[model samples]
Target: MRHEHEPKQRKHTVRNVILTVILVLLVSVGAYAARKYYNIKHAVDNTYQSAGIKKNRNANAVIQAKSPISILIMGTDTGALGRSYKGRTDTMMLITLNPKKDKTTITSIPRDTGVTIPGYESESPSKINAAYAFGSSGTAIKTVQEMLNVPIDFYAVMNMGGMEKVVNAVGGVTITPTLSFSYDGYTFTKGQSAKMNGKKALAYSRMRYSDPDGDYGRQTRQREVIMAIMSKAGSISSLLNKDFLDSVSSQMKTDLTFSDLSAIAQNYLGARKSVSQTHLQGTGQTVNGQSMELMAKSELQRVTNLNRKNLGLDHATTGNIALSVSDASSSSDSSVQSANVNAGN
Candidate 1:
């Protein structure tokens, strides 16, 4: 009777162990399947399709020399439906990521800055914001490329509707206001550091009339909000959630492919540490009976040099683009910078 009881106990223990192993395997497979399913679904839905974007199949060729890459970051006011021909870029930031120095520079163009439209020669000088309405991202990218004489490698365009979602997704953001100003029924006091949500964050950035520096003040706030977003983005927790990824996919329109984005995420994480904020210096004036912000020839050369130097390009070898601008500047004091042309503020 003792021997029989021992045999039964052994059989029961073996059976339980086998069942536990099976359960573990099943759980592991299920999790993998779920992850794969979500990845496929999101990829299909958010696959970027844009004309101006080009992929370097040989990633080695693109980054061998530690050259700087330029990305045009446009925050559109497209609401929930996403970007279209009719949409406008409410926020425009030109970001240059220098791999050699591991530095980044952000130049914010005012929405009200004046420029000449490429195709619409008859339209006279117009506000920079009107370029999108006149043409698509290709036009916008081209306009900026011409203005700055920098190659725009990629673009990440997102709607303002996602601003709130992004802030909430990241928990929240802390911002230090330089001056107190109220707009759109929101009140912010000077020297106050406030925790901002999405709507409040939008309000914080959009209030310009009350600011002493006009659009420059507003642009500064916008940069602050962007920095806050970047800070939240850096906290690894933000990237772990499937829900957050899906929401971001829905909100952003980009020319960046998944592989390109992955490489950028890996290689350029350190670039954010060296962010420099630059503003274009120009006097507000009217050109040909149209309101414009006229940037000096010297200022244009300075910007061009900064961009070229950041890109690790030998100024003499990087095509005659720089020289062309330099030559154009010699004849006319008011001759507009090509890179500044058609760039909406």
Candidate 2:
């Protein structure tokens, strides 16, 4: 009887020890996660900058209500190819997210498209990309609104060079080239899925001249790289790595604060299930030795209608607008626009 009772006590002691260890591990993990969340929140909070523009409705309220919204994505051509100068936005994609329908629409605005910068209305027909260079991101946002007659709720500017760093930060991105080409010491075969590093991803997105579809094809690749990054960045440990955070800190910017971002992520997670990609295919024209993509009035109306419908507005705003920039006619040549500094964790 003594031996049997001793064995029972030993079993109880082992069970208690196991339970204690498990409890300790759970507490440790919870604390670490809390600390990591605090750290990333602080890091993102530091990158916020207001454009000082008036809005029709409260942006935060829209998110809180789980309504659809628009975000202008600008890929600035700075911090790339060893160039340090503030540069024009090389890529502009307008994203509309509708949570109810779980759909996302991306409309690519041509980089060389023409529009009048807000402060310089008399200086009509400046390159749309010049909007940022002349008045920073505010000008760029206003330029898009004025051209499309659609309200832009937020803006995101990413340094093209920093895009490579982000690609690497997420352990690289996987993309299948729709067209076979090579640039910057990288070879891409059509219809092949390749895992691209930072530079290789840049090369894949930046090779416009060789694409059979020209700049439009390049736009598709750019969208592909971006989507890949978004899909991979969330599931990887690099998102919390020190170097990854640093790269994002110096290379990106936006108007959204940490709270705004967190709310959006919580509310809009379903909106990404369906993505429709479209672009403004404009006629390439050389005006005053400057290249331009002339978007027609009808074409403008179509895209605007789509955006408006997604925003729960009427398909109404469409009119004639001369928005092509010429080196031969303007007060100030569009300067290279500085990017906002906000980025994701």
Whole-model Cα lDDT per candidate?
0.56, 0.64
- Candidate 1: segments with Cα more than 4 A from true spot: 1-47, 52-66, 81-85, 230-234, 287-290, 316-345
* Models, CA RMSD each: 17.1, 15.7
Q: Which pairs of residues collide in candidate 1? A: 110-345, 111-345, 128-344, 146-339, 147-339, 147-340, 148-339
Model 2, span 266-309: residue lDDT tens: 66646656555557767777543456677777778878887877
TM-score of model 1 relative to the true fold?
A: 0.71
What tens digits encode model 1's per-residue C-alpha lDDT throughout 118-213? 564444255565566566566667666666666677666666667677677777789889898887678898888999988888789877778988
RMSD of 1: 17.1
